[model samples]
Target: LGRIQIKKTDGTLILNSLNASDSNASIKGLEFDKSLIKYQMYYSGNAECNDKGYVYLFFPDPNNLNQMKLTFMQEPDIIVSCPSGYKTL
Candidate 1:
């Protein structure tokens, strides 16, 4: 892996590669609110935001990734903003 490349999708790159395979990758933390609703079809996972005429999501680097259950699951790349705004569609 000796090339700088980009993986564009849904406004965010699910996986970014470094020039070298050993290079480190940074994935931010994700927080889900109890009031937030989850709309899988819209990739919206915040009930609070959903009820507030908005939606949000984050690709958090779960501190305990090992504890995560990933069984052929594909997560969303674009983390919604918040009870920030409503989706047109």
Candidate 2:
């Protein structure tokens, strides 16, 4: 199980790893910044982007940071199109 927190002002979110039935998972209030992903995509050589592909990011609870669980699920597709002369390049 996981928990999510969002700051209403700037769309900031903090995701915690407190599951419903898991009693051993605690992070001691470990938090992650959204910029971590952005930097990885931009500067850090941790991630890469292609014309069509998938991206995955994961963080563990501070207490169980060493433990990991991997799952796969299907998500809805999102589409964005430019209007008029707008360009994404």
Which candidate's TM-score is highest?
2
Taking the tens digit of each residue's C-alpha lDDT, what string does model 2 give over 36-67? Answer: 52111111111121112222335445466576
Clash count for candidate 2 is 1
Worst 10 residues of 1 by lDDT: 37-46
| Residues 1-89 of candidate 1: C-alpha lDDT, one tens digit per residue | 12223345565653334433434322222445565432121222233333212224423345644443211123434535554455321
Between which residue pairs do clashes occur in model 2?
Answer: 27-62
Q: Please report the TM-score between candidate 2 and the true structure.
A: 0.19
User: Pick by lDDT: which candidate is best?
Assistant: 1
Backbone N/Cα/C clashes per model: 11, 1
lDDT of each: 0.32, 0.30
All candidates: CA RMSD (Å)? 13.6, 14.1
